[model samples]
Target: MYSAEIILEQRTRALSEINLNGFGQRHQGKVRDFYSLPGNRRLLVTTDRQSAFDRILGQIPFKGQVLNQLSQFWFEQSSDILPNHMLSVPDPNVMLAREAQMFPVEIVVRGYMTGVTDTSIWTMYQKGSRQMYGYNFKDGMYKNQPLATPIITPTTHAELGGHDKPLSRTEIIESGLVAEEIYTQIEEKALALFARGQELCGKGGLILVDTKYEFGLIDGQVAITDEVHTPDSSRFWIASTYESRLGQGQEPENFDKELLRLWMRSKGFGGDGAPPALDEDIIARLSQRYIGCYERITGREFESDLTQPVAERIKANLEGLAL
Candidate 1:
């Protein structure tokens, strides 16, 4: 575990974008930069740039490496449940993956009713909304309360700088976005993946509160694509304090990006004109939280090389792979 003081002293930077020669077209997402490779493969580079409310929130130190390594860990751990896009981890901040026909929906699985976003179920419920994405919630449920069972609430995949609207299962098929048969398969896979996440986090004394999964068609089969169970894609709370916190009307201690989101909310930024610039202290704390998430979830020490530049290290590793 890295002490807060040590993490601040290291003070590494968020990686800048890179261009690899001989790679095909490049596609950049909120946090990942994707480049097409030969043989239907793609090179995905996770950058340190932080994004929330569907907007870029500057850079958090070592953010890219933490997300990439954590996603790589989950991809390897959960491959048996479903075939994923990952082919190999060429570097600490890079993953070479197979390109797939991406599904236009984000499969969000929720086991709790807490979040700071406008689209959060708790926000909607608190505003007197009983129905959400075809799931009905009964009255008298407290904030951050666990559900009877995990629910799959999907949303349309939005373009960059766009908001993702909530989508019901029926809307997905009725709108001709996904065929009924394929949607059924996606639902099954999403729930199974969530179960796997919950089981793993449970052993680590954490709760996989909710997570979003992306899927794509690979060789006529739906395969998991994008990051899975990372702090960026999921919400995790310390299990030991969950019950007491909820009872005391206190927020649970989270290891995910929710902490940053909360801080931004305090600054009155919410998918608006411009986000507030984060300071070095906030950056250091966020970096430690990310590293904390990695250690607690994977049960491994996060090996961050502050002495070496991240771009150079990734380039060297990729060259070694001869890709």
Candidate 2:
């Protein structure tokens, strides 16, 4: 059990010694590369690669830093809500997190209906269907409609090229992956975190619309793992215009992947094929959006030296790791 500071030191050392040819490549997700570390812990590195609609687009400068810092901000803020697997942040794009058996489900909670998935929900409503993946939905709902209360919709984590399927609580329990008591604990903690997130965002003049959460078992206890309320895991809407946008049937101004999704859709590219290259202007605008998200959410200016070379910065941070 390394303290956060020690873990950060170790990560810096490891980065200094990172073999470009053999960093013990463990697994590669859409935008992250996982490297094995001592014990069961793994080093998660956020690369510059950008992915939308499940397809990897060209790399965007500093995109990885934005994600890493965003996750770090949320982890620090929400530690009081529940224990997270965060051990330390080794570098701007690297995290030392606890190794746990990841529960196969992605827990999604929605406060307001919006976006493509929400549209899918409405389509199900119009067909008089009360359920999606066995979860019931009431009929005749309009867009951006508020739920009587927030609902938890769980979906199974899928492999590459595979689609995640929704699962009922009952199914999750019967699968024997987790005990009913533990599953209940996950539910309680997730909602509590979301509530806190809502409160914090409200103060920031933002609305936490919806988000996905992942959990893993640490020493037989379920804990929040991976990233928390970052822009990647959650949607943030400008608070002031939320009501006006809903009344006018306009989408709320948001800070999240929605903008990238819109760009992809405009080019008639879905997730299945290669994505079009984003122009420099669009890239610059998106970069600013990420920076803005950090400042607005944390109420602190982002003071990163983006002009420095990533590899050099990483090498300096890892100086202590050299044996």
Candidate 3:
């Protein structure tokens, strides 16, 4: 894996190199640029640009490397659990992945109910109704506390300028977006994967608080695709201070993008209009956080020369793939 610094510099340079017209920017997600590839595949490129509270912020040096490498690490470790669309790591920020009929929803599995979004769900529950999408929360004697069991809540993946709403299992099945049998398989696979991730994070002195999974059908086979269990796809908290922080009502130390999100929210941006520039100190600190997570989670230090241009390194990786 490339060092965090090298990854970030390369992502920045790659984004700068993109002409943004030739490939027909298929979709511009918060921090990723997707381009259609030949033979039913796509090139997903991570940008150093950060997004918080839904707003895209200034690019952070090496942020893209952290995201991509972390995802690659998990993909390699968890391939036994399910198949993924990963074709090649052509570049530090670029992934050549199999293009599938992407499910229109994001499968979110919550192990703990302590996030801001979870809190929103709880508040809605207290009103004697669970509100997800347009559906009312199921009626039952319920406590607005952490679930003894984690729940799978799926949300639609909306396009820019569109609202993404939640969908129940029945709704997902009835809508014909995905067959019932396939959805069940995805749920089972997702839960098993999340369980394994939690176990691994626990060993690494971190908690896999929650994560989102995406699925796609490839040649009639449903498979887990996209980034899995990365700092971007999941929230991880330091396990050591978790109990103490929970006791004091203080937020636990997290290893995910929440820090950047919190910072962006503090700047009064929430995915609307242009985001403010982040200062050098914040960027440096965030870079350290990414590297720290990689070291702690993998128990391996990231090694790469940051002084070298990322393009050369990426070109080398691609050439190695050709061999």
Best by TM-score: 1
Tens digits of per-residue lDDT for model 3, 81-135? 8888888787777788889888888898877645565334554565555565344
Q: For every model shown, what is its TM-score relative to the native structure?
A: 0.94, 0.87, 0.83
- Report, for every candidate in turn, its global Cα lDDT versus the true structure: 0.85, 0.72, 0.71
Candidate 1 Cα lDDT to native: 0.85
Candidate 1 ranges beyond 4 A from true positions: 3-13, 268-271
TM-score-sorted candidate list, best first: 1, 2, 3
User: Which model is ahead, 1 or 3, in terms of TM-score?
Assistant: 1
Colliding residue pairs in candidate 1: none
lDDT string for model 2 (120-163, tens) is 45555655667764566665677777777776778888889778
Question: How many clashes show up per model?
Answer: 0, 3, 4
Off by over 4 Å in 2: 1-23, 118-120, 133-135
**Per-residue error (Å), model 3, residue 208:** 0.7
